[model samples]
Every structure is written in C-alpha cells, then in structure tokens.
Target: MFVGCHVSIRNGYLGAAKTAFAIGANSFQYFPKNPRSMGVKAFDAKDAEACRRFAQERGLVSIGHTSYPTNLAVDEEDMRERTVKHLRNDLEIAEACGSLGVVVHFGHAKGGEPLEGYKRMIRLLDELLHDWRGEAKILLENNAGQGSRMGTTIEELVQVRSLLAAPDRVGFCLDTCHAFASGLWRGSNWKEVAAHMRSSGYFSSLAAVHLNDSVYPSGSFRDRHAPVGRGEIGLEAFSEFLQTPELAEVPIILETPAPAIGGHREEILLVRKLADRQEGVFDLEK
Candidate 1:
C-alpha cells in the first residue's frame, strides 16, 4: 500500500518529485507537459535528470500520467489522431524518465454506448501498444461512469485488456471515487468486490489505485473528487481497501485532499496509520 498522489509537473516536472518527498509518499503521478494544449514545449533535459535523480534518491515510484482532455473513445477522427499522438509520446517519456508507467483514462463518454467507446479505445491502445512494445508500461484508469465514459465497469476494462499486442504492457488503475459512485465497491462489502475483481478475470491487469472520496452519492456517476474522510465515501471504505489482499501489491495514491498544510499528505498518513494498526497487513520495511 504505497501512498502517492497526482502533483503539478508544469514547474519543471521535478516539482512533482519534491512534492512526493514533502508528503512522504512512496510514489507520485504527474503530467510531463500541458494537457490542454497541442503545442508541446521542449522538456528541460536538466529538470528531467533532476527528477530521475530525486526519485532514485528517495526510492519513490514515479508515474507519468497522460493528459485526459483527449478522448480516444470518441467517434471523432481528429480526437483519435490526437489521442494516438499523446499515447506514443507519453510512453516514450516514461521510459526516458526512468518512471514505472503512464496512466491514462479509458475515455470520457459523450452520450455513446460503452461498447462503441470500448472498441475505439481498444483500437487506440492496440495501435500504441504495438509501438510501446516493452519498457514503458501503461495503466488504463477506469472512469466514474459519467456521461459516455468507458471503463467505468470492470467488464469493459477486461475486454480492453484482452485485446492489444502488449497485453502485459498494460494494467489497471482503479479510482476509489469511481468505485463508490458506480456501486461496484462501497460500504463493508468490499470483500465481495475484491473477490469479484479477482474471480471475474479483471485482476490480471491490476496495477495501481487512485484513492479518492466522492462529492456525489453512491450511484451518482459524477466525477467530483473530495478529500479523503471528508465526503460520501468515508473512511470505513478506505479501511476495507487497506484490508484487501489483492490490492497489497498495488500502489494506493491519494487523489483526495489532505488536512492542514495538506493536499494528499493527510490522506496518505491516514492510510498508512490504518495499514500499520491493522497488524501484519502493510509491512513497513524499516
């Protein structure tokens, strides 16, 4: 249960590395460039080097998060082009930065069928996976079931994972808020959810998690993110996540807010406390 968070990489990219250390995180996620723009500025070689050194020095798992604006699942031809471009570049950047993986969304829905979106996404990922080959790993994040987004359900993700030449090159990053809002994971029944994720064949691509709280109610399918322990999802659910056996190897990162002087810091500490107090669950390698 390594704690991590998505931090700003705009300030020389190395800023995220510093943020990771500040929160005592075991890992960090960040964008290599501006997500909204098409024009890419040159990455500072020195800053990238600094990021690599900082991560190695602190033993932090650095994740290069892809820009989410481009929807690969969209039916538009232009979006497909843009998405393919980012996918290729993001993966290459991860390899260059000595990072573990590049995490990306399945695709935001625009009032379309999940299957249609999944097909588009599967095609896009397949194209990129062919080129990605090995080295830089990719993790597909499930959506919150908002609008027409694909991968909100585990089944859709399974289909996507089943395709692709680089199946082993890809994995999953479950968002806690999505899990709660989608009713796939909520309340004290997480044992069942954990079992379902495994017995249902979705566990093979499992990799990381985005720990978050929902601003909306369960089954809302909204994408609002709240601070940990301060929203509808609450701490008991997080307790369940900490206790799950299948998630032990996965990195649990706070996309939620923290307490004082905190973004995700307070949330990480809470999870760390829960993992530690729960006996032999999270081994603190001292």
Candidate 2:
C-alpha cells in the first residue's frame, strides 16, 4: 500500500507533499480549503503547478479530502447545502490536481433516522457524478459511530454504494481506529471483518485507509484517535491490514494523535515493519 498522512494544506498544496517526503511517504491527503468553514481558497496557479512538479520529482502521490463539516448525510438543510458546495469544490480541485481520490465523511444523521441520512448521501453523490469530469473517485470514509454519524458497518457503506447502482466511481476509506471501535476488532475477528466488507462488494470499492489506533475500547463508538499500536486497537488489526488484498493498491494514511504526545515515529515504523513482514504474525489484536 502507498503510505501517507493527513497533512495541513493551509500554507499551500505543495507544503503537503513536502511534509509527506519528510515522513518517508510517497502519498498524502490534504484539504483544498478551510476544513471547518467551507471557504474556498484558490491555489496560486504556479503553486498548484509547483506542487505537482515537486511531488512528481520525488515520485509522491497527492490526494484530497473535503472539509470536516462537509457531510453528505447531514439533515440540517443549511449544512447539507454547505456540504454539497464544499465537496464540489474539493472534487474540482482534486481533478485539477490529478489526484486519485477525494476522501469525505459520511456524516451524522442530525437526530433523524440514520438510514435516511445515507439515502440523502446517495442522492447528493448522484448529482456530483452527473457532470464530474475529474478522474478522482469519491472515497466515503467510515466514522467511529460517534453520535449520529453513519458508516459504522460495512452494511451502511455498502448501502450507500448500492444506491449508486454499484458504481465503480464510488470508493471507501476504512479508518482502522474506527474499525476497532465499531466492534470489528472483537476477539481477533479480522477475517470476519474482512469478509463482511468483501461481501459488501468492498474489494473494488475501497480506495484508501485511515491508519490509526483507538483511544477507546472495542465497540466504543467514540471518535478519539490514538497513535498507531499505542491503544486499544493493537498490532493484530494492523497485521491484517497488510494482508488484506483490497488495500494492496490503496493509500494508507495516518491520523494519529499529535507528535508531542509520543509514538508518532514508533507507530509509523511499526506499521511499516509489520506490513513489510507480511504472512506471519501473532494475534496482537487479542
């Protein structure tokens, strides 16, 4: 898998690529504009050009994610509209940059029936793809089941994908921390977890991964992310990550806690080592 991180793009898009190189990454994900406000920030033509050149020079892959608030399943009319605008902008930028995927959260139901939230998501995505020219596929990310958020199960994601009549343009970004917290890590259930997702037609639907350890328990449904291999979801889940064929061609991005708290380096190194070793490992998740 291509390894990377969720990086800050406030300085400029090129900064994201540069930071990836520092971490020995050949791939990365970044926001095209303010993540909270949906305020658009057009990159300098030369800056965008420079970003491409620099990443190409180092053989790096750049990916884009929409603002955190851009939720397709949000019930609030204003937020949903805002979500649509920001996602459209992200798709535009990602396409312009020739990025592979545009990562996005499925979003909270905002107190209504959660399934309806997914229906809303499907409707919105249909609109986005109606005229989208970009090659970048939309990668819907799973939540930790925090609050009213959707996407805790492969069923939910598969439901969303199915709504689009199983379109190949849609994809998934499986967050490891959320995977554990959603109960997929129960008693060394990696194979079951993998099977569930695959049965949902995930083999081709997944486009990337959010590699994180949990600061919560198995099935916590909480949204706290810990450094990799330093929390409840331990090495076993990660060992499965390397062997999972669906992720073999996807980008794996770290969403670990801040470096000052420690384990940032250790986490990266651990995943790199484990993924490289492949085929044989103990039950670290148990």
Candidate 3:
C-alpha cells in the first residue's frame, strides 16, 4: 500500500507536497479549497504544474478530498444543484492537480427511503460524468452510518455503483474507523472482511483508504478519529490490515488528528513500516 497522511494546504498545493516529503510520505490527501464553505479560491495554474512535476519526479500520489457539506443525496432542487456545481468544480481542481482520485462522502438520505437516496446519487454522478474527460476518478467514501448517512455497507456502495452501468470513472474509499464504528469488523476477522469485499466484487473498485483509529468503542456510530495505534483500534490490527494482499498499491491516507495530537510523521512512518518490511523498523517510541 502507498502510505501517507492528510497534509495542510494552508501554504498552497505545492507547499502541501513539501510537507508530505518532510513527513517521509510518498502520497498525501488535501482539500483544494475551504472544506466547510461553498466559496473557493482561484487556483494558480503555474503552481499546479509545479506540484504535478514534483509528484512525478518523486513517484508520489495525491488525492483530493471533497468538502464536508457536499451532499449529492439532497432531495431539494437548490441543494442538489449546488451539490452538482461544487462537485464538478472539485473534479476540475483534482484533474488540474493531476490527482489520482477525489474522495467524497456520500451524503445522508434525510429520513427518506434508501432507494431514493441511491437514485439521487446516481443522477448526480451521471451529470458529473456526462461528457466528462478527467484523469482523477471520483471515489465515494464509506460513512460511519450515523443518523441518515448512506454508503456505510459494501452492498449499498456496490448498489450505488451498479446503477451507473460500469462507469470506469467511479470508485470507493473504505474508511477503517467508519467501518469499525459501523461494526463491519472490529479489526479482527480482517481475512473474512477482505474475502467478503472480494466476493461482493467491490474489492477492485477500492481507490483509496482512510486509515484512522476510532476514539469510541465498536458500534458507537460516532465519526471521531484517533491517531493510528492511539485509539481503540490498536497497532496490531493495523499491521494486519496493511499486510492484506487485496489492498496492495492502494493509497492509504491517514485522517488522524493533527501532528501535535498524534504526530502525522510518526503515523506515516508506522504505516510505512507495516507496508514494507524491508524499510527496517525499530520499535515505536512512547
């Protein structure tokens, strides 16, 4: 697996790459603009080119994460229109940056029938991909299944994708903490988990992974993320996850707490060690 962490984009996209390198990461995740607001800052094409060149030179990968409020499952016309506009912008930015994937949270159904939500998602994606030619694939991320959230299960995610009639531009992002909170697997039975995913035919659709530990117990339905090895999901479990053959070469992005609380550098190194035994690991210092 390609191990990395979420890097800040405060210094601009090129600076985000520099921070990733400082942390010993060959991959990273970043939001192109403010994640909470609909407003977006104009991107500098020169800077984007520079960032792309830097990544290519170092054999690095980057992923663009969609904003939190981007709800493609909205029923209202205004909200749905806004969602389409913003996500289309997201796709453009990701393509300009030469990102491999754009990770997005599939929105909640707002207490409506699950089929309705799926249909909404399908229509939104259809519009997004219609006459689209972009290098970055849209990756629908799994949720914690809290409240009216959808795409928590492999079946639901697969179902959503199936409606698209084999769109090559669509994929999935499996969040470890979300899976744990939703009680998919408690970091044990990972082999069975991998087998099930493969059997469901969704394994090949995985484009990225959010490597996080949960702050709460299993089945908490909470989305709080702890640093790797510092929460309920222990290091041993992560070790097993990294060694899973099916996830090979996938971009594993850490969405853990910032470096001050959990240390992004350390977490990236830990995951790297898990992924590559030839890297030579010493014991993790407390």
Maximum-TM-score candidate: 3
Task: Give per-residue CA lDDT, model 3, range 146-251, as digits (tens).
Answer: 8775778888888788888437889988999999888886887778888889999888889889999999887788999998878888777888888888778888
* Model 1 regions lying over 4 Å from their true place: 38-41, 109-111, 258-260, 278-286
lDDT of 2 by residue, 1-286 (tens): 5777778876777777777788777778888777777865565667776787888788777778887667787667676666666777777777666577788877667775787877888877887677776678889888887787468778778777877843677888888888777776563788887787767787667778888888889888887888766787677667766777777677788888658644244456567777876543333444
TM-score of each: 0.89, 0.89, 0.93
Give each prediction's root-mean-square deviation over alpha carbons. Answer: 4.1, 3.0, 2.3
* Candidate ranking (lDDT, best to worst): 3, 1, 2
The lDDT, on a scale of 0 to 1, for candidate 3 is: 0.82
TM-score of 1: 0.89
Candidate number achieving the greatest lDDT relative to the actual structure? 3
lDDT of candidate 1 over 40-154, digit per residue (tens)? 4466778777888888887877777777575767678777777777777777777666677888877855677766767777788787677556476888888777776556778
TM-score attained by model 2: 0.89
Off by over 4 Å in 3: 276-286
Model 2 steric clash pairs? none
